[model samples]
Target: MSKVEDFEELRPLLFSIAYRILGSVSEAEDAVQETWLRFDGSATRPTSTKAYLSAAVTRISIDVLRSARVRRESYVGPWFPEPLLADPYEDPARSAELADSLSMAALLLLERLSPLERAVFVLREVFDFGFDDVAVAVGRSEAACRQLLVRARRHMAAGRPRFEADRQERQRLATRFLDALRNGDVGSLQSLLAADVQLVGDGGGKSPQLAKAVSGAENVARLLGTVFPWLVRIGVTFEPQEVNGQPGAIFRHRDGKILQVLVLDVLDGRIQTIRGVINPEKLDHLGPVADAWAADREVKQARREWG
Candidate 1:
């Protein structure tokens, strides 16, 4: 195939690799585009187009991540990865690995690793790339890449819950939870939550975030139970959808603009965490973002008048 054909064929894989490393859909797309530019400008064809493009995108993502980390250091409030509606790449052989690594929890875990270690782990562990290819992707020796992988695995394992709910069970619980939330049924919502469950919001100081993470089943359930109904009354609605391979919802303004994306992390038959990403900058790729500040005002006014 020609250069364009090869790049297009591998685009999904390249975007997936970059997205895993950078946690920003926009940045990942840029890395993939840059990879194509380098490939197109090359004087000769590579022996393995997949390997060549993968290495280029990985290296670019790693560099981008390093700078991004610096910015994140001073970021206001909690940070969550831009919500990914769907992953373009699919390999049945590595389906389990792919699904597990795409969660918001997994991406946040990746944030704790050094950029090189993150790249090595994503290429080797998640994508099942060979050691030689992994080494080339991160510009490290095979031995060094293996060492990085070991560290990444150790860090990720330390952060993961001991027993996570399977996909079907998690979906079932999310459905019930969303139903309870819509009804403002705090009792039902609490029943689905783990005792230590936490509801975290990532408005990145650009919107109305929780003053802090609300923890405990009662507290979280009450907060969701109260706030969401008010949002509904003020013309906000949510549609259940999968986000980052987990059950989630995309909330929209009355006019149908994006408001936020909420994802649930279920473990051991209960909802362990509820993550809401409301930063407009992060939501832009999903579609037209709502004015969250204005939405907040509307909610407050509706509560006072409707009550």
Candidate 2:
């Protein structure tokens, strides 16, 4: 493949790495765009496009992250990563690996690290890049990279287990949750939620959101019961999709407008947290879901008609 083609092929991985590091979709995308621009302007082709882009993005993200810290500190309320939906990959195993890279709680913990530490940890732990490669990516010596990884590991000691659910299991759980929501069955929905479940919504003030995180299983249950009934009344269609590597659902209106993207963080057998991103800015990358889900609706209708 040509350099451009190779870079295009690596875009998803690059975006994944940046998104995990930065949390904000816009910033991560900017980091990637800057990396591409630098690559395009380079005088000589690098021997390894992936390595070069990774390094470029990591370096750029470090710079962006520093600036982001100031903004985050000054922000109005708690900051949250933009939630995502997990769409299936052709290779289920590969999909599982990718999903691990997008977990919300995992990403939140990463914010505690320095930018370089975040890059090193993500490269070594998440991407499985060798210490030497990570060193080069972050402009550190191999020994320093190792030390950074150790520190980063300490920082993530309280993280959830890095277990990836099988495709069938994820799909089954997602379907159950969606059905419960459609039917306004709060009891069934509550059963699927973890006891310490957290519901975080990001409208970026563009759409409605809780002023603070609605935490605890009971509170989340109350909110869901109140909201789901209205959501169903509005004629929203829910589709199972992958977000941040876990089973998630997307809600769309009857007119095909994308309403929100729901990402779940499941622990053991129940969902430990829920992230709802209704921000139009964040939804832009998912493209026009209106037609996409409309087509899906049509297919389902045909099946029912035939049946």
Candidate 3:
């Protein structure tokens, strides 16, 4: 294949690496576009197109991440990676790993790692780039890259899931969990939430949301009873949909305005974290959800349709 064709074929991988490292869709897109510009204006064909493009994107992402971290530190309320629709990759295994890394919980954990470590981890773990390529991508020695990998792995492992839950079971639980909350069934919500469950909202101060993270199952449960009912009263409707590859609910105002997105992290068959992103800026990337989100469809039925 021609170099152009090769780069096109590998563009998805480049963007995935950049997005995992930066965790912002717009920055990732800009970095990819810049990478393409550099590739397109090259004076000579590189021996390996993948290596060249990957390095360019990773380095650009690292630059973007350095600034992103600072912005997030002062960000209002909670912060979340932009919710992505199913990523564009065609392979099943890669797509699955991408989903895991793109998850809000995983991204939050990643925030603790240094930018270099994040780049190394994304290239090596998420994209399965070889150490030699990772070294080139991050501008580190193979040995140094391995050390960064170890540190990144250790930091992320500290927050690893306690146990894997069945996907279908998790989805069923999410739907049921939302149902209980909507009906003001705090008792049922308490039963499904983990003891240390935490609920966080990212409203960016542009909308009304919890100012701080609320913890404890009882606290979150009581919170749902108070809040969900208010949303219902205000004509806000909820729909079950996949947010960042996890089962979550999106709230829309009666007029079809997107309100908030709730993404739950389940562990051992219970909800461990309730992540809500109401920041209109973050939801902009997910774009409009169509009129059906405002449709008065049953949550379970909607899950089947949107899932």
Tell me the whole-model lDDT of each prediction, alpha carbons only.
0.93, 0.75, 0.81
User: TM-score for each prediction?
Assistant: 0.98, 0.82, 0.88
Model 1 RMSD, rounded to 1 decimal: 1.1
Per TM-score, the best of the predicted structures is 1
Candidate 2 overall lDDT versus native: 0.75
The C-alpha stretches of model 1 lying farther than 4 A from their native spots are 161-165
Worst ten in a row by lDDT for model 3: 290-299
Better of 1 and 2 by lDDT: 1
Kindly report which residue stretches of model 3 are placed more than 4 angstroms away from their true locations once superposed.
1-4, 93-96, 288-307
Clashes of 3: 0
Q: Which candidate tops lDDT?
A: 1
Which of 2 and 3 is the better model by TM-score? 3
RMSD of each: 1.1, 6.9, 6.2
- At residue 157, what lDDT does model 2 achieve? 83
Writing each residue's lDDT as its tens digit, candidate 2 over 15-121 gives 77788788877788899899999999999999889899998988888888999898778654456677655422233545544566567767788888988889998
Write one digit per residue (lDDT tens) for candidate 1, span 1-307.
8899999999999999999999999999999999999999999999999999999999999899999999999989999999998999999999988888899999999999999999999999999899999988888899999999999999999996432547787788888988999999999999999999999999999999988999999999898999999998888899899999998999999999999999998887888889999999999998999999999999888878887
lDDT comparing candidate 3 with the true structure = 0.81
- Ranking under TM-score, best-scoring first? 1, 3, 2
